[model samples]
Target: MHLIDLRTLQQFVRVAESESISRAAQALHISASPLSRTILNLEARIGFALFDRVGRSLRLNNAGRELLVNARALLRDNERLMLDLQRRAGGTGGTVVLGHMPGALYNGIIPDTARRVQAAHPSIRFQFESALESEQLEELRRGRFDLAVQTQDVSDPALASRVFASERYVLLMPRDHPLATTAEISLNALVEAEWVVTPERAGPSLRSAFTAACRRQGFEPRVACVAGDIVSALALVAHGFGLCVAQESLVRFSGEQILVRALPLLEMQTVYRIVWRVDGLTPAATRFLEALAAPSKAATPRGQRKR
Candidate 1:
Protein backbone atom coordinates (compact mmCIF):
# COMPACT_ATOMS: atom_id res chain seq x y z
CA MET A 1 0.00 0.00 0.00
CA HIS A 2 3.04 2.27 0.15
CA LEU A 3 3.34 4.82 -2.69
CA ILE A 4 7.15 4.89 -2.82
CA ASP A 5 8.78 3.09 -5.74
CA LEU A 6 11.11 0.18 -4.99
CA ARG A 7 13.85 1.62 -7.18
CA THR A 8 13.72 4.95 -5.36
CA LEU A 9 13.66 3.20 -2.02
CA GLN A 10 16.68 1.14 -3.04
CA GLN A 11 18.51 4.30 -4.04
CA PHE A 12 17.69 5.90 -0.70
CA VAL A 13 18.98 2.82 1.09
CA ARG A 14 22.21 2.88 -0.92
CA VAL A 15 22.73 6.56 -0.10
CA ALA A 16 21.92 5.99 3.53
CA GLU A 17 24.29 3.06 3.70
CA SER A 18 27.11 4.82 1.93
CA GLU A 19 26.50 8.17 3.67
CA SER A 20 27.65 9.84 0.43
CA ILE A 21 25.70 10.51 -2.76
CA SER A 22 28.76 10.25 -5.00
CA ARG A 23 29.83 6.98 -3.48
CA ALA A 24 26.37 5.46 -3.81
CA ALA A 25 26.05 6.80 -7.35
CA GLN A 26 29.40 5.24 -8.29
CA ALA A 27 28.32 1.96 -6.73
CA LEU A 28 24.99 2.11 -8.55
CA HIS A 29 26.81 3.11 -11.80
CA ILE A 30 25.05 6.48 -12.09
CA SER A 31 25.94 10.13 -11.77
CA ALA A 32 25.73 11.71 -8.30
CA SER A 33 23.18 14.41 -9.23
CA PRO A 34 20.49 11.96 -10.47
CA LEU A 35 20.99 9.72 -7.45
CA SER A 36 20.59 12.74 -5.20
CA ARG A 37 17.40 13.63 -7.09
CA THR A 38 16.04 10.15 -6.51
CA ILE A 39 16.57 10.62 -2.78
CA LEU A 40 14.77 14.01 -2.96
CA ASN A 41 11.92 12.41 -4.90
CA LEU A 42 11.61 9.75 -2.19
CA GLU A 43 11.61 12.40 0.52
CA ALA A 44 8.87 14.25 -1.30
CA ARG A 45 6.80 11.12 -1.70
CA ILE A 46 7.17 10.31 2.00
CA GLY A 47 6.64 13.98 2.98
CA PHE A 48 9.70 14.09 5.20
CA ALA A 49 13.34 15.07 5.05
CA LEU A 50 15.36 11.88 5.33
CA PHE A 51 18.80 13.37 5.49
CA ASP A 52 20.60 16.42 6.80
CA ARG A 53 22.93 17.84 4.13
CA VAL A 54 25.61 20.33 5.03
CA GLY A 55 27.96 21.37 2.19
CA ARG A 56 27.50 18.07 0.24
CA SER A 57 27.90 15.94 3.35
CA LEU A 58 24.86 13.87 4.24
CA ARG A 59 23.84 12.45 7.62
CA LEU A 60 20.64 10.60 8.31
CA ASN A 61 18.33 12.60 10.55
CA ASN A 62 16.05 10.92 13.09
CA ALA A 63 13.34 10.46 10.47
CA GLY A 64 15.84 8.87 8.11
CA ARG A 65 17.08 6.44 10.74
CA GLU A 66 13.52 5.38 11.50
CA LEU A 67 12.63 5.05 7.81
CA LEU A 68 15.78 3.10 7.08
CA VAL A 69 14.59 0.17 9.15
CA ASN A 70 11.24 -0.02 7.36
CA ALA A 71 12.94 0.53 4.00
CA ARG A 72 15.33 -2.36 4.61
CA ALA A 73 12.43 -4.52 5.73
CA LEU A 74 10.54 -3.74 2.53
CA LEU A 75 13.57 -4.65 0.44
CA ARG A 76 14.03 -7.87 2.40
CA ASP A 77 10.37 -8.80 2.05
CA ASN A 78 10.62 -8.20 -1.67
CA GLU A 79 13.57 -10.59 -1.84
CA ARG A 80 11.71 -13.15 0.30
CA LEU A 81 8.63 -12.85 -1.88
CA MET A 82 10.68 -13.63 -4.95
CA LEU A 83 12.21 -16.63 -3.21
CA ASP A 84 8.79 -17.74 -2.07
CA LEU A 85 7.41 -17.53 -5.57
CA GLN A 86 10.33 -19.53 -6.93
CA ARG A 87 10.00 -22.16 -4.21
CA ARG A 88 6.27 -22.43 -4.72
CA ALA A 89 6.57 -22.79 -8.48
CA GLY A 90 9.20 -25.49 -8.08
CA GLY A 91 7.19 -27.35 -5.37
CA THR A 92 10.22 -27.47 -3.08
CA GLY A 93 10.88 -27.13 0.64
CA GLY A 94 10.73 -23.75 2.39
CA THR A 95 12.87 -22.27 5.19
CA VAL A 96 11.92 -20.69 8.51
CA VAL A 97 14.23 -18.67 10.75
CA LEU A 98 13.99 -19.20 14.52
CA GLY A 99 15.46 -17.04 17.26
CA HIS A 100 15.97 -18.22 20.84
CA MET A 101 17.76 -17.43 24.07
CA PRO A 102 20.82 -19.44 25.11
CA GLY A 103 19.44 -22.03 27.54
CA ALA A 104 17.38 -23.69 24.81
CA LEU A 105 20.41 -25.08 23.03
CA TYR A 106 22.25 -25.91 26.26
CA ASN A 107 19.77 -28.62 27.26
CA GLY A 108 18.83 -29.54 23.67
CA ILE A 109 15.34 -28.06 24.07
CA ILE A 110 15.18 -26.11 20.81
CA PRO A 111 16.25 -29.10 18.75
CA ASP A 112 13.70 -31.26 20.50
CA THR A 113 11.06 -28.64 19.80
CA ALA A 114 12.04 -28.45 16.13
CA ARG A 115 12.02 -32.22 15.80
CA ARG A 116 8.57 -32.34 17.32
CA VAL A 117 7.40 -29.78 14.77
CA GLN A 118 9.24 -31.48 11.92
CA ALA A 119 7.59 -34.79 12.69
CA ALA A 120 4.43 -33.43 11.11
CA HIS A 121 5.90 -31.02 8.55
CA PRO A 122 8.96 -32.64 7.05
CA SER A 123 9.24 -30.19 4.13
CA ILE A 124 9.83 -27.14 6.31
CA ARG A 125 13.44 -26.56 7.37
CA PHE A 126 14.49 -24.28 10.19
CA GLN A 127 17.42 -21.94 10.80
CA PHE A 128 18.23 -20.82 14.33
CA GLU A 129 19.98 -17.96 16.11
CA SER A 130 20.65 -17.08 19.74
CA ALA A 131 19.85 -13.44 20.44
CA LEU A 132 18.69 -11.09 23.16
CA GLU A 133 14.93 -10.81 23.66
CA SER A 134 14.76 -7.26 22.25
CA GLU A 135 16.83 -8.19 19.20
CA GLN A 136 14.76 -11.33 18.68
CA LEU A 137 11.51 -9.37 18.85
CA GLU A 138 12.86 -6.68 16.50
CA GLU A 139 14.06 -9.20 13.92
CA LEU A 140 10.78 -11.11 14.20
CA ARG A 141 8.94 -7.83 13.57
CA ARG A 142 11.20 -7.01 10.59
CA GLY A 143 10.55 -10.44 8.94
CA ARG A 144 14.21 -11.34 9.34
CA PHE A 145 13.18 -14.15 11.67
CA ASP A 146 9.88 -15.97 11.38
CA LEU A 147 9.53 -17.03 15.04
CA ALA A 148 11.11 -16.63 18.45
CA VAL A 149 11.30 -19.20 21.24
CA GLN A 150 12.19 -17.69 24.58
CA THR A 151 11.38 -17.73 28.29
CA GLN A 152 10.33 -14.09 28.43
CA ASP A 153 7.49 -12.11 26.88
CA VAL A 154 7.47 -8.50 25.68
CA SER A 155 4.58 -6.00 25.76
CA ASP A 156 4.46 -5.40 22.00
CA PRO A 157 0.95 -5.92 20.64
CA ALA A 158 2.19 -7.03 17.22
CA LEU A 159 3.74 -10.19 18.66
CA ALA A 160 1.93 -13.23 20.03
CA SER A 161 3.16 -16.33 21.85
CA ARG A 162 2.00 -19.83 22.75
CA VAL A 163 3.23 -21.65 25.81
CA PHE A 164 5.35 -24.66 24.89
CA ALA A 165 6.16 -25.79 28.42
CA SER A 166 6.27 -24.41 31.93
CA GLU A 167 9.08 -25.55 34.20
CA ARG A 168 9.44 -24.61 37.84
CA TYR A 169 12.65 -22.91 38.90
CA VAL A 170 15.06 -24.91 41.04
CA LEU A 171 18.27 -24.21 42.88
CA LEU A 172 21.44 -25.76 41.42
CA MET A 173 24.39 -26.40 43.65
CA PRO A 174 27.12 -28.94 44.42
CA ARG A 175 26.05 -32.15 46.19
CA ASP A 176 28.07 -31.66 49.37
CA HIS A 177 26.73 -28.33 50.70
CA PRO A 178 25.30 -28.68 54.25
CA LEU A 179 21.71 -27.75 53.37
CA ALA A 180 22.03 -29.62 50.07
CA THR A 181 21.15 -32.81 51.97
CA THR A 182 17.93 -31.24 53.15
CA ALA A 183 14.86 -32.25 51.17
CA GLU A 184 13.57 -28.64 51.19
CA ILE A 185 15.24 -25.27 51.74
CA SER A 186 13.99 -21.69 51.79
CA LEU A 187 15.53 -18.55 50.14
CA ASN A 188 16.28 -17.09 53.61
CA ALA A 189 18.53 -20.04 54.42
CA LEU A 190 20.48 -19.41 51.21
CA VAL A 191 20.76 -15.61 51.69
CA GLU A 192 24.26 -15.96 53.10
CA ALA A 193 25.24 -18.34 50.28
CA GLU A 194 27.07 -16.99 47.22
CA TRP A 195 24.86 -17.28 44.11
CA VAL A 196 25.11 -17.15 40.34
CA VAL A 197 22.35 -15.57 38.31
CA THR A 198 21.92 -14.26 34.76
CA PRO A 199 22.29 -10.53 34.04
CA GLU A 200 19.13 -8.61 33.12
CA ARG A 201 20.10 -7.95 29.49
CA ALA A 202 20.65 -11.62 28.61
CA GLY A 203 17.09 -12.83 29.15
CA PRO A 204 14.21 -12.46 31.62
CA SER A 205 14.27 -10.60 34.95
CA LEU A 206 15.50 -13.81 36.60
CA ARG A 207 17.99 -12.18 38.95
CA SER A 208 15.45 -9.53 39.82
CA ALA A 209 12.91 -12.19 40.70
CA PHE A 210 15.47 -14.04 42.77
CA THR A 211 16.43 -10.81 44.55
CA ALA A 212 12.79 -9.97 45.23
CA ALA A 213 12.23 -13.43 46.66
CA CYS A 214 15.27 -12.93 48.87
CA ARG A 215 14.00 -9.50 50.00
CA ARG A 216 10.65 -11.06 50.95
CA GLN A 217 12.70 -13.46 53.05
CA GLY A 218 14.28 -10.39 54.72
CA PHE A 219 17.58 -10.14 52.77
CA GLU A 220 18.90 -9.69 49.25
CA PRO A 221 20.70 -12.50 47.41
CA ARG A 222 24.48 -12.30 47.48
CA VAL A 223 25.25 -12.64 43.75
CA ALA A 224 28.83 -13.80 43.67
CA CYS A 225 28.69 -14.26 39.90
CA VAL A 226 26.51 -12.97 37.08
CA ALA A 227 26.39 -15.52 34.29
CA GLY A 228 25.50 -14.76 30.70
CA ASP A 229 23.05 -17.68 30.61
CA ILE A 230 21.59 -20.48 32.70
CA VAL A 231 24.05 -22.99 31.27
CA SER A 232 27.00 -20.97 32.49
CA ALA A 233 25.26 -20.40 35.78
CA LEU A 234 24.87 -24.16 36.24
CA ALA A 235 28.49 -24.60 35.21
CA LEU A 236 29.52 -22.18 37.94
CA VAL A 237 27.39 -24.10 40.42
CA ALA A 238 28.91 -27.43 39.34
CA HIS A 239 32.40 -26.12 40.07
CA GLY A 240 31.29 -25.34 43.64
CA PHE A 241 31.77 -21.62 43.02
CA GLY A 242 28.21 -20.65 44.10
CA LEU A 243 24.57 -21.67 44.05
CA CYS A 244 22.30 -20.92 41.09
CA VAL A 245 18.56 -20.81 40.57
CA ALA A 246 17.57 -22.32 37.23
CA GLN A 247 14.62 -23.96 35.50
CA GLU A 248 13.88 -27.61 36.21
CA SER A 249 14.19 -28.23 32.46
CA LEU A 250 17.91 -27.52 32.80
CA VAL A 251 18.30 -30.70 34.85
CA ARG A 252 19.22 -32.43 31.61
CA PHE A 253 22.54 -30.60 31.64
CA SER A 254 23.29 -31.29 35.30
CA GLY A 255 26.55 -33.10 36.01
CA GLU A 256 27.20 -35.65 38.74
CA GLN A 257 28.46 -32.89 41.06
CA ILE A 258 25.41 -30.69 40.41
CA LEU A 259 22.14 -31.09 42.31
CA VAL A 260 18.78 -29.53 41.38
CA ARG A 261 16.60 -28.58 44.35
CA ALA A 262 13.24 -26.84 44.44
CA LEU A 263 13.26 -23.42 46.13
CA PRO A 264 10.00 -23.07 48.10
CA LEU A 265 10.57 -19.45 49.05
CA LEU A 266 11.79 -18.01 45.68
CA GLU A 267 8.28 -18.93 44.39
CA MET A 268 9.37 -18.54 40.78
CA GLN A 269 8.28 -20.21 37.54
CA THR A 270 9.32 -19.84 33.89
CA VAL A 271 7.47 -20.75 30.75
CA TYR A 272 9.21 -21.61 27.49
CA ARG A 273 7.05 -20.20 24.73
CA ILE A 274 6.96 -19.91 20.94
CA VAL A 275 6.46 -16.29 19.90
CA TRP A 276 5.46 -15.08 16.43
CA ARG A 277 4.22 -11.98 14.69
CA VAL A 278 0.44 -12.09 14.62
CA ASP A 279 0.34 -10.70 11.07
CA GLY A 280 2.07 -11.55 7.82
CA LEU A 281 3.43 -14.99 8.68
CA THR A 282 4.85 -16.99 5.79
CA PRO A 283 3.50 -20.47 4.92
CA ALA A 284 6.53 -22.20 6.42
CA ALA A 285 6.20 -20.36 9.71
CA THR A 286 2.47 -20.99 9.94
CA ARG A 287 2.83 -24.67 9.12
CA PHE A 288 5.60 -25.18 11.64
CA LEU A 289 3.54 -23.55 14.36
CA GLU A 290 0.49 -25.58 13.45
CA ALA A 291 2.54 -28.71 13.82
CA LEU A 292 3.68 -27.49 17.23
CA ALA A 293 0.06 -26.80 18.16
CA ALA A 294 -0.81 -30.49 18.17
CA PRO A 295 -1.89 -31.64 21.62
CA SER A 296 0.50 -33.57 23.80
CA LYS A 297 -0.06 -36.27 26.44
CA ALA A 298 -1.69 -35.06 29.62
CA ALA A 299 0.56 -33.84 32.37
CA THR A 300 1.05 -36.13 35.36
CA PRO A 301 -0.08 -34.81 38.74
CA ARG A 302 2.75 -33.60 40.97
CA GLY A 303 1.77 -36.07 43.71
CA GLN A 304 1.76 -39.04 41.34
CA ARG A 305 4.97 -38.00 39.53
CA LYS A 306 6.98 -37.96 42.70
CA ARG A 307 5.86 -41.49 43.53
Candidate 2:
Protein backbone atom coordinates (compact mmCIF):
# COMPACT_ATOMS: atom_id res chain seq x y z
CA MET A 1 0.00 0.00 0.00
CA HIS A 2 1.14 3.56 -0.68
CA LEU A 3 2.11 5.67 2.33
CA ILE A 4 -0.35 8.40 3.29
CA ASP A 5 1.10 11.94 3.13
CA LEU A 6 1.30 14.19 6.20
CA ARG A 7 -1.15 16.68 4.68
CA THR A 8 -3.77 13.93 4.35
CA LEU A 9 -3.18 12.86 7.94
CA GLN A 10 -3.66 16.49 9.09
CA GLN A 11 -6.88 16.91 7.17
CA PHE A 12 -8.12 13.59 8.57
CA VAL A 13 -7.44 14.81 12.13
CA ARG A 14 -9.26 18.15 11.53
CA VAL A 15 -12.29 16.32 10.06
CA ALA A 16 -12.32 13.91 12.98
CA GLU A 17 -12.18 16.82 15.43
CA SER A 18 -15.06 18.81 13.80
CA GLU A 19 -17.03 15.68 12.86
CA SER A 20 -17.88 17.44 9.57
CA ILE A 21 -15.79 17.48 6.35
CA SER A 22 -17.21 20.90 5.27
CA ARG A 23 -16.43 22.52 8.63
CA ALA A 24 -12.85 21.12 8.83
CA ALA A 25 -12.11 22.25 5.28
CA GLN A 26 -13.43 25.73 6.13
CA ALA A 27 -11.18 25.81 9.20
CA LEU A 28 -8.23 24.67 7.04
CA HIS A 29 -9.03 27.39 4.47
CA ILE A 30 -9.50 24.79 1.74
CA SER A 31 -12.47 23.83 -0.42
CA ALA A 32 -14.65 20.97 0.91
CA SER A 33 -14.33 18.83 -2.26
CA PRO A 34 -10.49 18.57 -2.08
CA LEU A 35 -10.59 17.93 1.70
CA SER A 36 -13.08 15.10 1.19
CA ARG A 37 -10.87 13.60 -1.56
CA THR A 38 -7.75 13.83 0.73
CA ILE A 39 -9.54 11.95 3.54
CA LEU A 40 -10.82 9.36 1.06
CA ASN A 41 -7.29 8.89 -0.30
CA LEU A 42 -6.01 8.38 3.28
CA GLU A 43 -8.61 5.68 3.97
CA ALA A 44 -7.79 3.91 0.70
CA ARG A 45 -4.04 3.91 1.48
CA ILE A 46 -4.67 2.40 4.93
CA GLY A 47 -7.24 -0.10 3.58
CA PHE A 48 -9.97 0.97 6.05
CA ALA A 49 -12.78 3.49 6.46
CA LEU A 50 -12.01 6.10 9.14
CA PHE A 51 -15.46 7.57 9.76
CA ASP A 52 -19.06 6.41 10.03
CA ARG A 53 -21.46 8.61 8.00
CA VAL A 54 -24.47 9.92 9.91
CA GLY A 55 -27.42 11.70 8.26
CA ARG A 56 -25.58 15.05 7.95
CA SER A 57 -22.16 14.68 9.63
CA LEU A 58 -19.43 12.09 10.39
CA ARG A 59 -18.31 10.35 13.59
CA LEU A 60 -14.76 8.84 13.93
CA ASN A 61 -14.53 5.04 14.04
CA ASN A 62 -12.10 3.23 16.40
CA ALA A 63 -9.39 3.08 13.70
CA GLY A 64 -9.67 6.83 13.14
CA ARG A 65 -9.20 7.53 16.87
CA GLU A 66 -6.08 5.35 17.02
CA LEU A 67 -4.57 6.98 13.92
CA LEU A 68 -5.22 10.46 15.31
CA VAL A 69 -3.33 9.67 18.52
CA ASN A 70 -0.27 8.18 16.78
CA ALA A 71 -0.17 10.83 14.05
CA ARG A 72 -0.18 13.66 16.53
CA ALA A 73 2.70 12.08 18.47
CA LEU A 74 4.78 11.51 15.32
CA LEU A 75 4.21 15.07 14.18
CA ARG A 76 5.32 16.45 17.52
CA ASP A 77 8.50 14.37 17.49
CA ASN A 78 9.27 15.42 13.93
CA GLU A 79 8.83 19.07 14.83
CA ARG A 80 11.27 18.78 17.75
CA LEU A 81 13.83 16.97 15.62
CA MET A 82 13.68 19.70 12.97
CA LEU A 83 14.10 22.45 15.54
CA ASP A 84 17.14 20.76 17.08
CA LEU A 85 18.75 20.30 13.67
CA GLN A 86 18.18 23.93 12.80
CA ARG A 87 19.72 25.11 16.07
CA ARG A 88 22.79 22.96 15.50
CA ALA A 89 23.16 24.18 11.95
CA GLY A 90 23.05 27.76 13.19
CA GLY A 91 25.71 27.00 15.87
CA THR A 92 23.41 28.07 18.70
CA GLY A 93 22.57 24.72 20.34
CA GLY A 94 23.33 21.02 20.70
CA THR A 95 24.91 18.56 23.11
CA VAL A 96 28.62 17.64 23.18
CA VAL A 97 29.60 14.35 24.79
CA LEU A 98 33.04 14.66 26.38
CA GLY A 99 35.36 11.93 27.58
CA HIS A 100 38.03 13.17 29.98
CA MET A 101 40.41 12.29 32.77
CA PRO A 102 39.54 13.22 36.36
CA GLY A 103 42.22 15.89 36.26
CA ALA A 104 40.24 17.79 33.63
CA LEU A 105 37.66 18.70 36.27
CA TYR A 106 40.37 19.89 38.66
CA ASN A 107 42.49 21.69 36.04
CA GLY A 108 39.88 24.47 35.55
CA ILE A 109 40.06 24.45 31.75
CA ILE A 110 37.15 22.10 31.12
CA PRO A 111 34.82 23.57 33.73
CA ASP A 112 36.00 27.12 33.11
CA THR A 113 35.70 26.91 29.35
CA ALA A 114 32.34 25.15 29.57
CA ARG A 115 30.92 27.91 31.74
CA ARG A 116 31.97 30.53 29.21
CA VAL A 117 30.41 28.62 26.33
CA GLN A 118 27.13 28.21 28.19
CA ALA A 119 27.07 31.90 29.04
CA ALA A 120 27.15 32.72 25.33
CA HIS A 121 24.95 29.91 23.99
CA PRO A 122 22.58 28.89 26.74
CA SER A 123 20.98 26.23 24.62
CA ILE A 124 24.23 24.28 24.17
CA ARG A 125 24.72 21.43 26.63
CA PHE A 126 27.51 19.16 27.80
CA GLN A 127 27.76 15.58 29.03
CA PHE A 128 30.91 14.55 30.85
CA GLU A 129 32.40 11.08 31.35
CA SER A 130 35.49 10.67 33.50
CA ALA A 131 37.75 7.68 33.07
CA LEU A 132 41.39 6.65 32.81
CA GLU A 133 43.41 8.25 30.03
CA SER A 134 43.61 5.02 28.05
CA GLU A 135 39.90 4.33 28.38
CA GLN A 136 39.02 7.87 27.34
CA LEU A 137 41.26 7.69 24.28
CA GLU A 138 39.78 4.35 23.26
CA GLU A 139 36.23 5.65 23.61
CA LEU A 140 37.14 8.75 21.63
CA ARG A 141 38.54 6.68 18.77
CA ARG A 142 35.33 4.65 18.70
CA GLY A 143 33.25 7.81 18.24
CA ARG A 144 31.42 7.43 21.55
CA PHE A 145 32.76 10.87 22.54
CA ASP A 146 32.69 14.12 20.62
CA LEU A 147 35.88 15.39 22.31
CA ALA A 148 38.37 14.35 24.99
CA VAL A 149 40.68 16.14 27.40
CA GLN A 150 43.82 14.22 28.30
CA THR A 151 47.58 14.41 28.81
CA GLN A 152 48.91 11.65 26.56
CA ASP A 153 50.26 12.64 23.15
CA VAL A 154 47.85 11.35 20.51
CA SER A 155 49.79 10.64 17.28
CA ASP A 156 47.01 8.94 15.33
CA PRO A 157 46.49 10.59 11.97
CA ALA A 158 42.75 10.08 12.23
CA LEU A 159 42.65 12.31 15.32
CA ALA A 160 43.62 15.96 15.90
CA SER A 161 44.61 17.59 19.19
CA ARG A 162 45.67 20.90 20.74
CA VAL A 163 47.48 21.69 23.93
CA PHE A 164 45.27 23.98 25.98
CA ALA A 165 47.21 23.90 29.25
CA SER A 166 50.11 22.27 31.06
CA GLU A 167 50.73 21.34 34.70
CA ARG A 168 53.64 19.90 36.62
CA TYR A 169 53.34 16.85 38.86
CA VAL A 170 53.47 17.56 42.61
CA LEU A 171 54.06 15.34 45.59
CA LEU A 172 51.16 15.02 48.02
CA MET A 173 51.77 13.93 51.59
CA PRO A 174 50.09 13.92 54.99
CA ARG A 175 50.35 17.36 56.62
CA ASP A 176 52.57 16.04 59.39
CA HIS A 177 54.75 13.77 57.28
CA PRO A 178 58.49 14.38 57.68
CA LEU A 179 59.07 15.47 54.05
CA ALA A 180 56.06 17.78 54.16
CA THR A 181 58.24 20.49 55.74
CA THR A 182 60.63 20.47 52.81
CA ALA A 183 60.06 23.21 50.19
CA GLU A 184 61.06 21.00 47.25
CA ILE A 185 62.10 17.36 47.50
CA SER A 186 64.37 15.48 45.20
CA LEU A 187 63.27 12.21 43.54
CA ASN A 188 66.38 10.50 45.01
CA ALA A 189 65.37 11.64 48.51
CA LEU A 190 62.03 9.78 48.21
CA VAL A 191 63.63 6.46 47.19
CA GLU A 192 62.64 4.90 50.50
CA ALA A 193 59.17 6.54 50.76
CA GLU A 194 56.08 4.39 50.07
CA TRP A 195 54.10 5.60 47.09
CA VAL A 196 50.42 5.53 46.08
CA VAL A 197 50.16 5.12 42.33
CA THR A 198 47.74 4.29 39.52
CA PRO A 199 48.14 0.81 38.08
CA GLU A 200 49.04 0.32 34.42
CA ARG A 201 45.69 -1.17 33.55
CA ALA A 202 43.78 1.87 34.75
CA GLY A 203 46.05 4.37 32.97
CA PRO A 204 49.47 3.44 31.67
CA SER A 205 50.68 6.91 30.67
CA LEU A 206 51.19 8.36 34.15
CA ARG A 207 52.38 5.09 35.64
CA SER A 208 54.91 4.35 32.94
CA ALA A 209 56.20 7.90 32.89
CA PHE A 210 56.60 8.03 36.69
CA THR A 211 58.31 4.67 36.66
CA ALA A 212 60.73 5.82 34.02
CA ALA A 213 61.42 8.99 35.97
CA CYS A 214 62.09 6.94 39.09
CA ARG A 215 64.41 4.56 37.22
CA ARG A 216 66.42 7.51 35.94
CA GLN A 217 66.96 8.52 39.57
CA GLY A 218 68.51 5.06 40.24
CA PHE A 219 65.59 3.44 42.14
CA GLU A 220 62.12 2.07 41.50
CA PRO A 221 59.16 3.62 43.37
CA ARG A 222 58.07 1.38 46.24
CA VAL A 223 54.31 1.03 45.76
CA ALA A 224 52.26 0.94 48.97
CA CYS A 225 48.83 1.28 47.37
CA VAL A 226 47.37 1.25 43.87
CA ALA A 227 44.35 3.45 43.12
CA GLY A 228 42.27 3.80 39.95
CA ASP A 229 42.71 7.55 39.49
CA ILE A 230 44.63 10.56 40.79
CA VAL A 231 41.82 11.66 43.16
CA SER A 232 41.83 8.30 44.88
CA ALA A 233 45.62 8.28 44.95
CA LEU A 234 45.57 11.67 46.68
CA ALA A 235 43.04 10.36 49.19
CA LEU A 236 45.43 7.54 50.02
CA VAL A 237 48.17 10.10 50.63
CA ALA A 238 45.92 12.09 52.98
CA HIS A 239 45.38 9.05 55.20
CA GLY A 240 49.14 8.41 55.48
CA PHE A 241 48.90 5.43 53.16
CA GLY A 242 51.84 6.80 51.12
CA LEU A 243 53.10 9.71 49.02
CA CYS A 244 51.35 10.47 45.71
CA VAL A 245 52.60 12.33 42.62
CA ALA A 246 49.81 14.05 40.73
CA GLN A 247 49.02 17.06 38.56
CA GLU A 248 49.33 20.35 40.44
CA SER A 249 45.78 21.31 39.47
CA LEU A 250 44.48 18.66 41.86
CA VAL A 251 45.78 20.64 44.86
CA ARG A 252 42.36 22.25 45.14
CA PHE A 253 40.87 18.89 46.00
CA SER A 254 43.43 18.26 48.74
CA GLY A 255 41.78 20.91 50.93
CA GLU A 256 43.41 21.49 54.32
CA GLN A 257 43.79 17.77 54.98
CA ILE A 258 47.03 17.28 53.07
CA LEU A 259 50.28 19.05 52.25
CA VAL A 260 51.31 19.61 48.60
CA ARG A 261 54.99 20.03 47.71
CA ALA A 262 56.79 20.90 44.51
CA LEU A 263 58.97 18.30 42.81
CA PRO A 264 61.35 20.60 40.96
CA LEU A 265 63.85 17.75 40.95
CA LEU A 266 61.61 15.40 38.98
CA GLU A 267 60.76 18.01 36.33
CA MET A 268 57.61 16.15 35.30
CA GLN A 269 54.90 18.13 33.58
CA THR A 270 51.68 16.84 32.01
CA VAL A 271 50.31 18.88 29.12
CA TYR A 272 46.56 18.94 28.94
CA ARG A 273 45.05 18.83 25.46
CA ILE A 274 41.68 18.73 23.69
CA VAL A 275 41.40 15.99 21.06
CA TRP A 276 38.79 15.01 18.49
CA ARG A 277 38.37 12.97 15.34
CA VAL A 278 39.91 14.76 12.40
CA ASP A 279 36.55 14.75 10.59
CA GLY A 280 33.77 14.33 13.11
CA LEU A 281 33.21 17.56 15.02
CA THR A 282 29.66 18.91 15.00
CA PRO A 283 29.16 22.67 14.70
CA ALA A 284 28.48 22.83 18.42
CA ALA A 285 31.73 21.03 19.15
CA THR A 286 33.59 23.46 16.91
CA ARG A 287 32.08 26.41 18.77
CA PHE A 288 33.17 24.90 22.07
CA LEU A 289 36.71 24.44 20.76
CA GLU A 290 36.78 28.04 19.67
CA ALA A 291 35.82 29.12 23.17
CA LEU A 292 38.59 27.03 24.63
CA ALA A 293 41.14 28.69 22.33
CA ALA A 294 39.95 32.18 23.23
CA PRO A 295 41.76 33.75 26.16
CA SER A 296 39.68 34.38 29.28
CA LYS A 297 40.21 35.78 32.76
CA ALA A 298 39.67 32.39 34.43
CA ALA A 299 43.10 30.93 34.90
CA THR A 300 43.98 27.25 35.05
CA PRO A 301 45.83 26.15 38.19
CA ARG A 302 49.56 26.32 37.57
CA GLY A 303 52.67 25.68 39.71
CA GLN A 304 50.57 25.32 42.87
CA ARG A 305 52.74 24.19 45.76
CA LYS A 306 50.61 23.81 48.89
CA ARG A 307 46.93 23.82 49.76
Best by lDDT: 2
Model 2 misplacement above 4 A: 1-3, 26-29, 44-48, 52-56, 61-63, 131-138, 183-188, 202-204, 302-307
Could you tell me every candidate's TM-score relative to the true structure?
A: 0.63, 0.86
lDDT of 2 by residue, 1-307 (tens): 4876677777887998999988998999999999888888788878899899997699989998899998888778878888998989988789989998656777677887888888999888999998777787788888889899878788889999999887788778898888877766766569989999987854546788788888877888999989977778878888889888887777877867788777766678888889999988888889889999999765567435434
| C-alpha RMSD between model 1 and the true structure | 14.2
For model 1, where is the 10-residue window of minimal lDDT? 298-307
Instruction: After the best TM-score superposition of candidate 1, give how far the Cα of residue 237 lies from its true spot, in angstroms.
Output: 1.3
Report the C-alpha lDDT of model 1 over 1-307, residue by residue, as the tens digit: 4588788888989999999999999999999999978888778877889999987778999999998999999999999889767764443347789998766554444565567656765666789998877788889999899899777666789988877766677777888877778766754568778888888654466776677777777887787888877778878888887898876656766777887776777778767788998896777677667656655442211211110
Score candidate 1 by lDDT.
Answer: 0.76
